[model samples]
Structures are given as C-alpha cells and as structure tokens.
Target chain A: MAEALNKAGSYFIGLVRVIVMRILIAEDDLDSQTLLKVILQKEGHEIVTADNGLAAWEKFQQEDIHLLITDWVMPEMSGLDLCKKIRAQKTSEAVYIIMVTAKEEKQDLITAIDAGANDYITKPYDKGELIARVRSGERMVSLEQELINKNKEIYSEKEKSEQLLLSIFPRFIVERLKQGEVVADSCPDVTVLFADINNFANIFSRKEPVELVEILGQLFSVFDRLVSAHGLEKIKTIGDTYMAVGGIRKIRRL
Target chain B: MDSNEKEKIVVSVDPDFEEIIPGFLEHRREDIKKILEALDGNDFEGIRIIGHTMKGVGGGYGFDAISDIGRFIEAAAKENRPEDIRQHTEELASYIDRVEVVYE
Candidate 1:
C-alpha cells in the first residue's frame, strides 16, 4: 500500500510543482516550437519538444508526461489521435492535454474536445492566455497531489499507532480497546513457567543473599534470552523463581 | 533597390526570443521558393502545407501580418486561385524585406 501510494503521489507532484514546471510541446513548425519553448523556459520550466505527432507519441510512450501541449495537424498522426491514445492507456496518472492549432472552426473545437483534449487554443494565440492555462492546470494537479500526500501521512500515522499499541498490550486486548470495550478477557492456552536455580539451598548456605542475587541475575538473563527467542511473554521474577507465559497475546506450540 | 526598400520598420518582440528571429525569417524565405515551385507543378497539397505552417507560426512571433498572408495563401490554394497565391507570396516577400525586429 505504501509503495503504490508513493508511486501515485510522485506521478502528480512530478507533473506540476510550484517552483519548477515540467512541460512537453508538440509543434511541427520550428518557429512556433522555438517561441513556445522560450516562453516556458523564461518561466523556469524544463521542456521537451517533438516536431510531429508520431514523434510526440513515441516520447510519451517512453515516459510519463502528465502535461502536454500539441498541434492539431501533423504528418503520421493528428493531435486528436494522440489524445485518444493517451486516454486509452490504463494508468493511475492524470493527463492534461492542450490542443494548439489553426483549426478555429466551431466544429474543430468540439471535435478536439470530444477526442479527449482537455483544452483548445486557436492559432495566433495570446501569450498571456497560454501561460494562464498552464498555471491553472498546474494548480489543479498541485491541489490533488497535496490531498494524496495528506492521506499518505494519515496512513503512516495509523500504522505507527498500531505498532506502538501492539508492543505494550496483547492483540485481543488491543482489539477490545479499539472497539472501546473494557479490555478484560481470558487468555487461553498460556503456559506459566516458574523456574528456580539448581542447588538452591546449598548455594544459599555457601553464599550471602546479596551474592545469591548476583547468581539469580545471571540465571534470569539466560531465561530472558529464551523468552524472546520462543516468543513468550515474561510476567515477573520473584525471589528465586522466574515466571513467564506463552499464548497470551500470540499463540505458540510449547 | 526601391526608394522604400531601406525604410526601417520596427517590430517589438520579447528580447528572450531575439536569437530565433533570424532562423524564422530564413525559413520564410525558403517557403517563398517552395511556393513558387509548388505553383509550377500545380501541387495544391504542397502549397497548402507551407501555408498552414506559416499561419501556425507567424502570429506567435508577433508577426500578425505574416499570419494574415499565410491564412490568405492557404484559403487561395484551397479555392485554386493561383493569382491570389502569387499576390500573397509577393506580400510575404515584401513583409520580410521591411520587418525590423526591435526586441523589447
């Protein structure tokens, strides 16, 4: 879930950032291509250019381009066909295609939109309008990216809480707490162990209680290692006995 | 040279695009030749392509006159008006000759 969410998040953020712009321009004419490239470059954008529709399509196939500006007519392929192709691909990424062309008739605009162009611009386009549309698209994509990032953060927080809770309490108790129920339930199949050091009386005769405690500490250390290794929960250590239990939170074969 | 040939006409363009103006004008000069050849062969399609290219790029570089001529050229080719194509082709040549781009 985390990996998939990150992939989706990056897809949106990479397309439009507030500081830097990532754009692709598909125009066959060298003069128009240069102007468009220069205009966006002045705005601090990174750009890719394609001379014809087929070349543009190939570039799109090679990588993910979320924002594209294309001319309507070209050799090998038309902008409308390219729009249809991009829309047909099954991917989580969202695309914003702006069709720039000399086709200014009412029907041409309608046809381009129907073929999956998000926006349309007639020839002799205003420079201000071009930048404004790009800004608007970037705004929309940025808002959506922000929302996805927020959701991802919330998901991470939920997972962290779950891990912290599971460390302190048993699974069943945690589940009960989650449901807002009083967490009092009987644990089945738990094995309680009361282990004592060997030669308990003789060792006590030979040593003082302070010295006996040192030996008890060493014994408990060994038992501590075994408890974690076998996935058992330690209850307590009283006097000379070490108490532990298994199957309280998690089930195990003893 | 005509009396008005050296009469400098200034066109304001973005200074950032100064480098591209030369190449753009060169392409238009090439188009004049291509248009004349296409007319000789009566290749309406070839003429139409060049005209379409001009209409698309001319206004973008702040040369609205070039775009107007291009639009007319394209329309004339479609209607098979060879006289109008020749007229527009001459207009394009004159426009290029007099344009003095004053980069802003």
Candidate 2:
C-alpha cells in the first residue's frame, strides 16, 4: 500500500511538472526542418515551424516563444536580420536564440554574436551537440524564470516585514530606525496626553482574569485607533494607563 | 555503379539521413539546374541566391563538398566573376552526380 501511495504521489507531481517549452524553427529546407522538428519533439518541446525568417518573426510575435533555432539564409530575410528584430522587440521575457548555419568562419561567428544570437551552431551539426546546445538554452531560460520568481518572493517578504514593523512603531520612527539613526528627540512645542481606565480594581474584582484581560484589550484597541485618528504618536501602554504625544522637535546646534 | 565513382561521393551521417537523403539529392539536382540557367542568363544575383541556399542546406545533410562549392559560387557571384562561378557550378554538379549516402 505504501509503495502504491508513493507511485500515485509521484504521478501527481509529474502531472504538475508539465513545462513543455515552445520552440520556433526557421529553416527554408524541408529536410532540415523535419530533422530539427523530429529531434526537438523527441525531447518533449512543442515545435512551431516557419519556412523563412519573415515567417519566423511573424510566429514569434504571435506566440510566447521560449527558444529559436534559425538557419542563416532564407528567401525574404536572413537569420541575422531576424535575430536583430527579435532582440529589438520590447518583450517581457528573454527569448533564447541559436543561429544554425554552414558558415564556420570566425568573422561569421562574430557577426552572429553581434547581431544578438545567444549561441551558434555550424552545419553539418552533430545531433548530440545540437541537443546539448539546446538543452543549455533551456537551462538558461528556466534560470531566468526562476530568478524572476525569487525576486517576486523577496518583494512579498519585504512587504510582510514592513507591515509587521509598522504595527510595532509609527512610520517616521520606523524609517529613522531603518536608517540606523538615534531616535532621541526633545520637542519644544507639543501636547502630551495620558489616560487611565477608572475603577480598574473594582472591574477586575468582579470579573474572571481572562474576561478582565479581554475587556482591557478591547478598550485599549479603541484608544489606539483614537490616538491615530487624532494624529498623535502612541508612546506606551502601561497596564490601564495610555500615553501619547503630538510634537514638533527642533535639533539643537552644537 | 563503379566502385571508384561510389567512393568519390560519400555521405557519412546518422540513421536519420536515410529518411531525408533521396529528397535532399533531388533538391540538389534542382539547384544545379537553376544554377546553370542563372549562369547562361548572366544573372549573378540569381546565382548568388541559389549558392547561398546550397551553402546553408548542403552540409546540414552531410554534403560538406556541396557547401564548399556553394560558398565558392556565392563569393564568385558577389564579385561578378562568371568564369569562377561557372567553374564552381561544374564542380558542384559533378559532386552531386557522384554522391552516395551511407548511414551510420
């Protein structure tokens, strides 16, 4: 039973992990197109094919493409042009591009890199090498997505911590504390208010400890809101007594 | 076919080559015809297009010789050298005619 349960759990996790990437292949030759499609499909990537660079650019605009494999020469536009155009687009996600061509000259490689190709593969490309390069591209694309998710998580954590800090202190005081500044201040013009709950001993004597504490809690919360509405800074709550201050502080010049 | 002729043109590729070799050879033959017509018409631009296409597609299908010849033709066309382009086209045609595919 335990073994079967484990199998079922893994199967469910596998179902949730279906991150099949969308890859665009722009090769004019039918044979080369078929070869690339077959290889990438076998690796579980969804393929979108175009016969020329112009068509490839169109498909890229229409779809959420994760990767591109393009031949250098085509009818309408060359692969280098397509690479430049794709790079110029203001897309939110980075599209990994691999230029596949027969040109193996160092200058050709430099041109491809300068035109914004992330990687280059020369023909006749070895099947294993092609797959390995594509796998590397996949790793890079996924790493970028992982970094984006981590950043979002960090932002959310920061917001939560800020909320917790705000609950403990006033906003200005929290800012000063964050800046590592001393919080001592002498206010020349200020109003200090203090309030104490009356008949506190009599109320405590009549009620259970828990009930009395609950009552005090509700009463103090009301006072806290009132202090904030009146634009006053709450200093501290000492048992039944509440203290707050409103002031302008002047720095003493040495 | 003669053993010498067969040995002259060889395609060393993976098993997937079997599925595409026939079509690839047919395409090369068509490209040869186009190259000849472009040469006869002195249409250097047309020749360059065909050469560029071959250069891109030939080696991909285990025909590095075709890619080399195509590169020569493309460069000659860019320079508008009819004699050099014709010579490269002749070499390309002979290479295609003598070619044989061997799957690894």
Candidate 3:
C-alpha cells in the first residue's frame, strides 16, 4: 500500500478506491493490443503497449510497470524470452507477468512458467477472466511491493538502533553488544578526568532547546577530539559535564 | 456454402466497448483486403499475422466466429493451403458483413 502511493499510484472511485495499475501489453497484433487496452482502460487502468517482445522489454526498462500482459509468440523476441529476461534481472520489486497464449498453446504454459510468467490467460480471452487474472496480478504486485517496503523499514530501524547503541558505548562494546554479548569490562590503573562547561545553566535558560543541543554537540565534538589526541577514551557525557579515562589499554601517567 | 444467411448475426457486446466497436469492426474489414493482397503475393506470413491478430481479439469483443475464422486462416496459411486460406478469408468477409453489434 505504501509502495503503491510511492509509485504514481492507486485510485479512489466514488467513496472507495481501487489500485489502478500501470499495465504493459506486449502483443504483435494491433487488434489484440488495442482491444486489451480498451478493456483494461475501461477499468480505470493506465495502459501502454509494445508491438512485440523486444519493444516491450525496452518499455519495461524505461518505466516502472506494475503488471505486464504479453502474447506468447511474436516477431523480434518471443514472450517466453521476454519473461526470462525480466525474471533474470534483479529488480528491487516484482512486476507480475501474465502470458497470453493461443488455446492450442495451453500445453506450453509449463514452458511459460519456467520462463517466469506469474499467470496465464488464453487467447480469445473471456473479459471476466482477463480482468480477474489482471486483478490477481495486481494483488501479487502490491503484496511483493509491500514486503519490499517492510524489509526496508526493518533495515532502517535496525540502523537507528545501532546508531543509538554506538553513541552510548565504545566501539568494541557496541560490536560485542551487536553480537548478543552481555559485556563487562575491567579497567584499573587509569587516570580519570571530568570537566564541566561554565555558565551552562545560563546558556540553557537563554537559548532554545535546538540551539542548546547544537552548542553542546559542537563543544562535545571538540572535547572528543582532544581526549583522543591525549590518548584517553571518552567514558560518557552528563548534561554539560565531560568524562574520559586514560590508559584503558594499560597504565599511563596523568 | 457462403450465401445462406437471411438471419441477422447480432453480437451482444458490453456497453463499455460501445465506443471502439465501430473502429474495431472496421479494422477487421480492412483485414479482408489485406488478406486478399497477401494471398495474391503468396505473403503467407503477412496473412498469418492478420489471422493471428483476429484470432486473438475477435471473441473478446463478442465475435467468436471471427476468431475461429482467424485461427483457420492462420493455420491454413502456415501449412501453404491456399484454398483453405481463401475459404476462411471469405468466411471472415461474410461474418463481418452479416454481423450486427448491440451494446448491452
């Protein structure tokens, strides 16, 4: 649903909305091409046509088609080859392919399936059945798209969690935490340093929250570089106070 | 066997297709001329393409007989059966002549 809105998108009819797919028809026959367009267009779909498989492939490359309806046989490239090409390319999302075949070519659908068609409709197609299959394709396309969107959301959320973890913990600690470890560290014979910014209370009272955050961020970044330069590990920060420890690896002079 | 139709062959089409039916039928009418031209030149591929097109679309618009004739024409053309192609082409011509469309 989110994916549909992202891509040109579904339509609301009257009070209810239906997904209006951007469909591509790849048939060499002009009559069939126009007829398919007319039938699908009446359903409020956006229809585009290619006279054969090669042209269809070109169009598929140029645009984001939600569904593809292709005839099995044609000049240039056959629909089977076109399906194979589409399936072979690693697309971020799916495009549902409905292969249109002559009734006699029904036996060849195993081949069509092997070539990567998601569905089949026989020639001299029944309008009801044709629309049904296209609807099925739309459902599959929308679901696959929804799944892709969900995976992306999961990845972004995971990144956010990792960023937060890294901000609180040291690199090794964060790495170990990511590995599902319950971490405890022993640090002895180290010099501990703590510093607090002067007039922080006055600044906090005077500045906006956003401005206060920016000022602290800049000051903390400078302090972090200084700590690193002095061979100290930043322990943590509390309000305007900064903390660090030297010789986390070994004993060091203050 | 071509001239026995005193009855009107009325095809009931969906109202949604009412707009394009005239143009669609006219396109099929032109196919007859093209089939004849292709037949004269032994351009079997050309005839087969025309037949293949009609075969795919005729029934979609409530014209099954046109699709049948188209299939017959395509098959006959592929097998080098000139007589069969001519016969089916005539059937196509006849069907187009006698057919009437009423939107439902």
Winner by DockQ: 1
lDDT score of residue A4 within candidate 1 = 27
Candidate 1: which docking quality band?
medium
lDDT of 2 by residue, A1-254 (tens): 12323311111244553245689999997867987887788777779999999999999999889899999888799999999999888876757999998777999999999999999998767678889999899888877766776888899998998887776666777777777888787676898888897887886787888987788789989988998798778767777888888763222221
Q: What residue runs in model 1 are displaced by over 4 Å at the alpha carbon?
A: A1-17, A151-254, B1-8
Per-residue lDDT tens digits for candidate 3, residues A52-124, read 8899999999977889999998889999999999999999967999999775554687888889999888888
Q: What is the CAPRI rating of model 3's predicted complex?
A: medium
Candidates in order have lDDT scores of 0.81, 0.80, 0.84
Per-model B-chain TM-score: 0.93, 0.88, 0.92
For each candidate, give its TM-score against the true structure. Answer: 0.69, 0.69, 0.85
As a whole number from 0 to 100, the lDDT of residue A104 in candidate 2 is: 76
Worst 10 residues of 1 chain A by lDDT: A1-10
Query: What is the C-alpha lDDT profile of model 1 across A110-166, one tens digit per residue?
Result: 999999888898888878888888877766656655666688789999889987787
RMSD of each: 8.5, 6.5, 4.2
- lDDT order of candidates, top first: 3, 1, 2
Worst 10 residues of 2 chain A by lDDT: A2-11
TM-score of chain A of each: 0.57, 0.65, 0.84
